[model samples]
Target: MQDGNTNTPEVETETATDWLTQLKNVIIEYAPAVIAALVILIVGLFVINMVVKLAKRVMEKRGLDATLQKFLGNLLSWTLKILLFVIVASKLGVETTSFAAVIGAAGLAIGLALQGSLSNFAGGVLIMIFKPFKIGDLIEAQGVTGVVKEIQIFTTQLNTPGNKLAIIPNGSLSNGNIINYSAEGILRVDHVIGVSYDADIKQTKEVLMQVMQANDKVLKDPAPTVNVSELADSSVNFAVRPWSTTANYWDVYFKVLEDAKIALDAAGIEIPYPHSVEIHKGE
Candidate 1:
């Protein structure tokens, strides 16, 4: 029994030595491939970065939309990286055909999960193509009104009149109605000024016209108009319409109103306020 057990240990030791030799042989045979894969990975990553940078510069030089430029850059970088990884894996004896199949399956699953994100991306593409509105356009949509600050793949940034920043999803923005106040180069400002019925209608109209004309910001070709719009119990209302450049719309609007009030007052026109008469009777 002692002799048999001693021989068993010897056999076991020989088997262990043989396994180590096989492992060493395998490493020696594949060492060059492993090193090559590492080199390729490192160099490929550097090249991918360079290519992406070049693409970004070209897009910027072409004056592409900032949002589209960024999206394309990211997409290009990711595609190049994936291709490089597959090549490196193939160098190391990985079956890239099967790897590509796995990647395709994963992509499908991810796409299905991100349906909403895909919709927004599609909407952004549509917005870029059609271009109903662009940066710096004062637009009203989705129950919010603001100047377009930036457009992105998923959302749009707006600077509201109150200086608030609003982030709206591109999906809704593309689908909904957009009223671009700045689309037309000019805007018509409408105002109604009321004066006492005793005031001269002709004189009030003339005074309003003078106020509008005095503002150089107001356009002269279209010609501003002041006409009797309504007759109320206390006053006659004159509709004062003036056309001005969109940039100066608000300035012209407020200045014209202020000047009209001043002009009317100077002309001795009375702006009547509501009043009630009280009567006392014996009970």
Candidate 2:
């Protein structure tokens, strides 16, 4: 019984040794190719990193947009790295044709699943190229009105006048009509001023014209127009239109309104307020 047990132990040990020997032989046979593949991967990665850095530096030196620079740099780096990996795999006896087909299939599936994201990405690229709006420009699009803060590959960031941050998808922005208030140097300010129905319309118009002329910021070429637009039940409305530089639009807007009010009061124009009558009846 002891002899049989000893023989059994020796047989197990021999089997283990044979399996290890076969594994080592297989590794040795492919050692050169494995080393070559490893070297290629390491060198390729290093080169790609250097090239990407150089490209980024060049873009920076050119004073390109920050968002565009970052997107381009990352895109180039990822593409080169992926290509290097594929080449390295091929060197290591990997069937590159089958691998590429598999990768393509997977990419197609992912693209189909994330179609919206891909569309946004494409839209972002178009925006970067066309440059309809720049940083700090006040734009209204996609039912959002705000100052453009940052543009990324998928979305644009906006800082609203109310101190709120909004993120809008690039696809929506691209598809919708965009109103860039800052694009033109000048902006037209439109507002209506009301006075009591008994007030003299001629005098009110003259006072408003004087107020507009007094403000130097308001453009004179267009000639400020003050016309009787609507005759409401409580008051007479005058449409006041003035043109001013975009930068000074709000400043001139408020100034004109306030100055017009003071001028109107001095001219004895009465601004009527909404009022209701109350009646009491005996039951």
Please report the candidate that would top TM-score against the real structure.
Answer: 2
lDDT of 1 by residue, 1-283 (tens): 3554555878899999999999999999999999999999999999999999999999999888887788888989999998999999999999999999999999999999998888888888888767888999999999999999998888889999899999988898899999999998788999988999999888888889999999999999689998999998778999999999878988999999999889989999998988889998989
List the pairs of residues colliding in candidate 2: none
- Which ranges of candidate 2 are over 4 A from the true structure? 5-24, 196-202, 216-223, 228-236, 272-283
Give the TM-score of each candidate: 0.80, 0.84
| Poorest lDDT segment (10 consecutive residues) of candidate 1 | 1-10
lDDT for predicted candidate 1 compared with the true structure:
0.91
- lDDT per model, in order? 0.91, 0.92
lDDT at 121 for candidate 2?
98
- For candidate 2, lDDT tens digit of each residue in 20-130? 999999999999999999999889989999999999999999888889999999999999988998999899889999999999999999999999999999999989878
Cand. 2 TM to true fold? 0.84
Prediction RMSDs, each to the true structure: 3.3, 3.2
